[model samples]
Target chain A: MPLKSVYKLYQDMETEQSIISYKGVVSADLLTSVLNIMEDKLAIIEESVSIRKKVYNVLVECLQNLYHHNEGKGTFTKNAKQSISSDKASILIISKPADFYEIKTGNFIENQKVEKLKSKINHINNLDKEGLRDLYVSILNDGEYSNKGTAGLGLIDIARKSNKKIEYEFKPINDQYSFYCLNVKIN
Target chain B: MENINLEGTAKTPSVSFEYDNGTIELRGRSIPENSVEFYRPLNEWLKEYSTCPQPKTIFEVKLEYFNTSSSKCLLDLFKLLESIPKDKTSVYIHWYFEKDDGDIEEAGEDYQAIVPLPFKMIEVDEI
Candidate 1:
């Protein structure tokens, strides 16, 4: 962490035309603040009410997914005697690079959970608008809630609203954990 | 049965279920961190209301936006409303959406498809 890097970070955000960027622990209170801020920002940037509503709806799903999945704190053994701590903090960035708004989120997840999540997103990505709507309704009727009260419909809802394939990646962090990043574009 | 009137917040909706009149209302946003906890009491209240409901029950949902989790809870509420015997009580649901909000309109349609309750979609200038 150097003094000059702070300026560089600011420059990068400006270059991306970022509306808002946040990192660290994601909690319910923080989610409220983020939503309020985004509502105000989108109100100014987007003139059409429908597009604003769509972007706001998609943003809610994305932030909630990040909050539910963030690990917060974890430790990994580096060697026989040394250990490294991983802050499993989550990240959210809303930027407008072109005509569309780009929402990017990142969080830590269990390594074993990577394949299942990847496959789910892939399945959602492969569906057309009508197929996605059917899947969403079926899941809404039959899907069981997880311990965290999520019904596994977040990604599907995001796909349906954005009308675009979800872009994601899972970067292995250690034997037990991986960093998951999701990027969604709303036009 | 006792009535329910909860104030709306930034994350949760305002609810008013009058047991005597059978007028149920849910308005505003519903994206609580724990949607289950927030909607559990309402679900229970609906279950109780079903046992001896009024002649005609009117349930109005005028939500600006709701997350996926809240959507599931809302469906649960609708199912309970659907369970009430039609011979005993007839339930009417009015799903409200703001102008140009297709997502909310579509959501109402989705619920109408699953639950056999009489649903009316109403569009307005604002919510």
Candidate 2:
């Protein structure tokens, strides 16, 4: 990571009206505390019941997705070599941009998975409301669980609740790994 | 039949299935890390309840927050209720949400549409 790019990232976050941002290992216990803290923060800022719920719901999905698939931390993809140097780590930023709250999450992933993930996200972004809802129903009933016993519903749930398209970028860190970043918005 | 009462924690819901009252209420937030493990016992209890369900079993769900994993467990619970012969056990799921919380109402509708039963949406001041 270059100094200029890091500085640019900092400036971007600074202007996005960030409520909170965190980096490092994402554990189950950490998720519990983060959710509690953010719940209180959301209650104080938003008076509309629906917006608060939408933001909160989307936040949970984002955090859970990080906890489930972040490179070496989660018990997904048994064949991939264990990554070193903050590969288990993920970043979370809750920001208020314009009329919507953006939950931005970044985590390291095996480079080979970039195309698969990009396709999945782009497929979700292209869906109409009805398509998303129908997809949610089928995914829920599909009974497919990851090795960690997660139902793989985190991303779909985020897309269903989020009224806006999910934005993302896959920045290659090395030949072996890349940083998968996603920005989901709620109105 | 015996009652199934479990206290809520920071990451789990409070469950109270009183056999005497024929009422089952699930309240509070449910965001357990391993939701499948946390909800397995409840599903087993529901299995037992199915064998000897009351004439009229009423489920009152007043959850403020729950994860997608817990969401699946809830659907499983509703599906179990749908299995019991209506003539033997008339099950009614009352989904309570705080007023102005359209998201919860939408969640309830999602469950209502899937489960064939008299699932009512009730608004409250708070849970």
Candidate 3:
């Protein structure tokens, strides 16, 4: 496997029409900074309130999931060949295409948890709009719903806001963990 | 019990509770690192407020954004306020959002559907 050069990653992002691309440790402080920058960028772009709200809302959920699920295991670096090690690693990109803005996130998860994560994504993808809403409400009201420091409403909320199927792919990085990528389209 | 009034930050919303006037307001962005921790005190305050419930209480929430964790915490706050007897206290939730933001309006509706309160969706020109 060839290593991804930092410059090539920039060029690819340029071709993909992405703005505000970050790949590294995702701390709470980073979330705030990224949100401020995203808000400024969104304001300059002059999108409708509904679209802006959707993007912002989805971004929040994505950042939360990234922060919560990041096990500090997978190397959180733009280029794995680099020796930089930042704990709590993840990737976030906001791209604007012709029709809609796409928010893509990449992170690492333990191999043991891959099956559960895949099943959750599959369940969310299979749900209709109404099903998503019901799930969101159900989890919200259930006081006992607790796992890995989340109410499990992040995915449901993301699916609900996107109004589309949540796209996700998993790749085996090693025998221990895999790289999980999620794609959310906001039109 | 003293009312809880704290300023907002870039990640957390500002909290204001006026026991005298019966007004509880949370405005600004809400995506705190630990929402349960951030909202625990407010929930405790509401529990104490129910002891000497206000006659007419108004809960105003004007948030620009909130993550899933904060969403659950907000629901907890609302549920606490909802526990106050309706006969003793008339509660109204003023959920404000940008006029063009259907997402915020619907978020408010989600809360309205779950909680038994008179939810007023206020449309504002700006967030």
Q: Rate the local accuracy (lDDT) of all candidates.
A: 0.91, 0.84, 0.84
As for lDDT, the candidate ahead, 2 or 3, is 3
User: TM-score (chain B) for model 3?
Assistant: 0.96
Candidate 2 clashing pairs?
Answer: none
Query: What is the lDDT for A84 in model 3?
Result: 32
On DockQ, the candidate that comes out on top is 1
How would you encode candidate 3's per-residue C-alpha lDDT over A1-187 as one tens digit per residue?
A: 2476877877888888887889898888898899899889889894586788788889988998898888645344445575434356789988986578889998877889999989999999999988887788888888553664467888898888888888899987666667789999988
- Model 2 misplacement above 4 A: A1-13, A73-84
Off by over 4 Å in 1: A77-85
lDDT per residue for candidate 3 within B1-127, as digits (tens), equals 6888899998888999989999999999888767878888898888888889889999999997888888898898888888888888998999999887777788898898899889999999876
Question: Second chain of candidate 2: TM-score?
Answer: 0.96
Residue B33 displacement (Å), model 3: 2.4
- Model 3 ranges with Cα > 4 A deviation: A1-8, A74-87, A143-149
Cα lDDT tens digits for candidate 1, B1-127: 9999999999999999999899999999998878999999999999999989999999999999999999999999998988988998999999999988989999999999888899999999988
On residues A50-101, what C-alpha lDDT tens digit does candidate 2 reach at each position? 8888888888888888888878433444246753465588999899978779
On lDDT, who's better, 1 or 2?
Answer: 1
Interface RMSD of 2: 1.5
Q: Give the alpha carbon lDDT tens digit for every residue of A30-127 in model 1.
A: 99999999999989988988989889999999999988877736677768987646574788999998999999998888888899999999999999
